[model samples]
Target chain A: MEENDVKNRFKAVVIGGSAGSLSVLFEVFPALNPRLNVAIILVLHRKYSGDSSLSDLLSTKTSLPTKEIDDKDPILPGHIYLAPADYHSLIEKNYSFSLDVSEKINFSRPSLDVTFESAADTFGPSLVAILLSGSNDDGTAGLKTVKEAGGFIIAQKPETAQMPYMPQNAINNLEIDLILDSKEISDFINMLNQ
Target chain B: MIEDEEIDLLLNDVFEIYGYDFANYSRASLKRRIIRLFALDKFPSFAELRYRVRTEEDYLKRFIEEITVNVTEMFRDPSFYKVLRTEILPVLGTKPFIRIWHAGCSTGEEVFSMAILLQEANLLKKSLLYATDLNPSVLEKVRKGIFPLNQMKQYSESYIASGGTKDFSTYYTANYGQAKLNEDLSEKIIISTHNLVSDSSFNEFDLILCRNVLIYFDKDLQERALKLFDESLGVLGYLALGSKETLKFSTIQARYKQLDKEKIWKKTM
Candidate 1:
């Protein structure tokens, strides 16, 4: 599919990563248009509880309004939602988020796989799943679900990732649509807005 | 997409037939669970599932279990238990008799964790732990106090992190891939069924641990539960919530004060 066709088809975008994700997000968020008509969900692994500073930090770098997800919060267009620490945020069919305190998967709560799989189930062909830099293979299975659901899948190029295991796993296991660095990812999201 | 009317009708039928009130639950979570049930049971549509739920006696039992999210572990959040041990328990020790309620205590992992905590603090002899849940099946499991042996390793780690002084293995005996918690711990525990949504508070409590349960409730229901908690707690009693949950937005927010970073709040008024 053409880039413009893919852009128009998308309704939601989900990005998952752990280590080395902050800098990449800083680069990508600034480049995206502020008024893009799509909801963006982020899942990043953290070692502690109550660290909600992530949303505030991201808001400073991006024009899109960012907030930590509250349970049952509605998904709105042109807004950025970050999964709160220590909860697995699932995208419900009603286009709202449900937080679960289930046992951690892949040794992480706010599991990348959990959010991506739920987003795939909810948005299906209209979703975009991005696997970014991380030290673990958490997003591979989730990216596979997105690919099987006919959603576009992007994996940060392995060499470009500060910690490549996560994106590299996705590239090896799934048929990813795009493999781009942080700058290219920024440009890709910018293109989607146009 | 399932229509709003269809969901309302289905929930009304569930309440009328099963006496389980899910009307006030967060709609998104309820809908997702229902959809998941439909997919899991291979029901073609919500109407078909609703028919089965209304008519089939055995199906309702499984349906209830499926809809209720029971994701808990022993000492699930070690820091919360740490706070209870280092700070809260010492204060509660001054009471003539301590009453601790574990609301929505699914399968009793945390309740057992609490029992162990109280025992370690030398308060078990004078303390009474009331563990309650909406699901009878889970309450039965709580009464038995047997957990999968595989989880003991993880539980031991959490126990240590929560400032356990004794060997964690001494609390339970493993056999046939299951660990039976020491029977002495059950002496002071009373397991019963209580619905936070529909049931009134049975007794005032010194400490109430209702962690991770409120996240499944909507704002109104959360307020209702909080009000119930406030009424059930004695003045200066402690209420422990899940790490992600907060009383800041609740209607009774001013009635409590944060006692620690681990989400322990004390009822002041």
Candidate 2:
């Protein structure tokens, strides 16, 4: 299949990261095209601060709609959804969101693998998953699941990332389709806008 | 790992054979939990899983427990508790007696938190804390009122943030790596097995808390559960839900007025 056809098949962009992902997100979020029609679901690991400010902070960095995910929220195109602290956000086959406060995987409530595996099961070929900068190997298994489901996978360049272990682990273990730097990642997303 | 057909098959078997209706629960969560249990238990095929659930009563207990999400904590969302302390309880304190129902109250962390609040307000004697869930084993834990010793540190912090005045340590005694709560707090609590999917409301309540439980249900089931709560709630009662849940989508939305930006609603009539 042609690359353009594959790009057009995408329905959601699920981004997973931890540790030093904040800096990479700031750069990429600011550059996201307002016209991009894919939902951006962010699964970032962090301490449970009893407030919903991360989404508010990211909303200031971009024009696209951004907010913390709630239970049973619909997955609308061109919206950004942040996984709430202390819960795992899941993708539903009906193109909506579901939440669980069950046991945390990999010491993180919003585990990347839980969401990624669910997204792969739900979205399958229509999913475009990106593994960003982090200090752990949480997203690697999720990326592998995404790839097995015929979804496209991208990893941030380890050398350029604030924390290299996350992307580096993926590059070492998986056949990532695109391993790009921050600027290239932004450009790739902008390409989808067209 | 399981397909939609397999999920349907399992749901039907559970209801037809076991008399527990879960067809109204959200398919997304049911699918995930079923897949997880299949993998964790190392069932060779879907057929094997069905056979065990059909014949073995013990496995059915485990299956029901897994399907219901049980993760809970004391004083979760401290700010929400803070509002309960300052605003909601003050009004409830004015009543001659108070009745609060903790529907789907898994392990009773939130119940303990509320009991503590009532005790602090000098209303524990007059208040009844009916903690109910579908799982009997979970209710056993609630009746015991013992939690991990290590978790108390975080619960203590959460208590302080929720406007608790006394030292949080006074509530429990730590021994054998478990903190057993005082009997006085659990005195007002009544534990029972109540299935929200099918059970009828037994008594009207001034406050009904079904936090995070309805998220596992489909939209129609959510509305059904909300209506059941409406039937069980008094005219001027309060209804609280999970932090991200709302009254906006349910049929009961019209009569309820939201309290500030919190997920709490007051039935105005």
Candidate 3:
């Protein structure tokens, strides 16, 4: 289905990435309308710290209200939540954050695979997953799971990514729905909102 | 909707035919893991994967690895180990016979780290470690007690951070870009295959380190694992979890006391 066709159906949007993710997030998140009813979650890699300042960093670039997710933070519309450093932030049935110190996958503790997989279990088909730029094959398996469970899948254009390994790996393993450049990815997000 | 019961049926078939029992595992995690494997094999359906797994032994091996959680490291959560050395050691105090269980031990990094700690604390002579996991593939590597040299730098940092008094290099001999932990560390270690879900406790221990494993389980499974640990821990035994994990919500939380602020719980009763 086209982005506009499924706009109102999704509960939330989830994006996963690693090494070369900042540029991709810069592109995709800005185009999302702050007024849209859907919330966005970004699971990125960072060192362990009590207060990760990622949401502040992204808020300067986008109109949406972004915040680093805290333990038990409610899932709210028009807000962007970046998974806090050093913990795998998951969505509970009550729409609250459930932080876990689960075993690492793909050598990362706050791994994209873990977040994407957990979100798929929570939201089911009402989820959208995007695999962006990164160096390793972290998000490939999780992307496949999201797609299988009725979620849409998008990948960054590998050639345009600073680190192509992750996008290429996911593209190699699964039939991704869209592969777009930064501007086009922004347009796609706008289209999803429309 | 794939009902939970159908998933249970699939898991049961896998265990009966392939000897890989994941039936009792947390349903959500088992579903995610199996779905991942199903995608990798390009099975048209979960049933198709189940059919092939029943007839193919190699598939069984691959399935075992897929279901098994292998992400671990030496002295992971350095602060926890530091607490173990400083706070728990004097309490243990070189018992005539000390038993330790490193449950869900993946490839044995933690096992070696514990052995080194016990040896340094002058408790090795009385200590025996039962290192276990559901996957036998990694147990073979644990038996060998070897790790890539590339990880040595990180492991060394964790060791020192965990309050090691000896040179990290003193514990291993480098050969062909791999560091083989000295044979002495493996001497008191019995590496074996054991499951937290399907298997019951076989031995009581003075300390049981089961970090980062319970978070994958749902509340019920978490409680189940805690009950097993509660049953397995000797009086006043120490139990450590991942830095983010705690005994707070589990059924056995009342039976244990927080050892330190680092998420270690001690059997209180």
**TM-score of each model's B chain?**
0.96, 0.98, 0.90
Clashing pairs in 1: none
TM-score per candidate: 0.84, 0.97, 0.72
Output the better candidate (1/3) by DockQ.
Answer: 1
**Candidate 3 chain A worst ten-residue window by lDDT:** A93-102
Which candidate achieves the best TM-score against the true structure? 2
Which parts of model 1 are misplaced by more than 4 Å? A1-12, A18-23, A26-39, A45-80, A91-96, A103-108, A117-128, A133-153, A157-179, A190-194, B1-8
TM-score for the first chain in candidate 2 comes to 0.96
lDDT of 2 by residue, A63-169 (tens): 99998998889999999999999888887778888888888888888899989999999999888889988888798989999999999899999888889999999
Error of 3 at A11 (Å): 2.8
Q: Sort candidate 2 into its docking category.
A: medium
lDDT of candidate 2 over B19-131, digit per residue (tens): 98888887777788888899989999998999999899999999999877899999999998999899999999999999999999999999999999999989899999999
Q: Global CA lDDT of candidate 1, please? A: 0.87
lDDT of 3 at A13: 80
Scored against the native two-chain complex, candidate 2 gets a DockQ of 0.71
Q: Order of all candidates by lDDT, from best down to worst?
A: 2, 1, 3
Cα lDDT for residue B269, candidate 2:
91
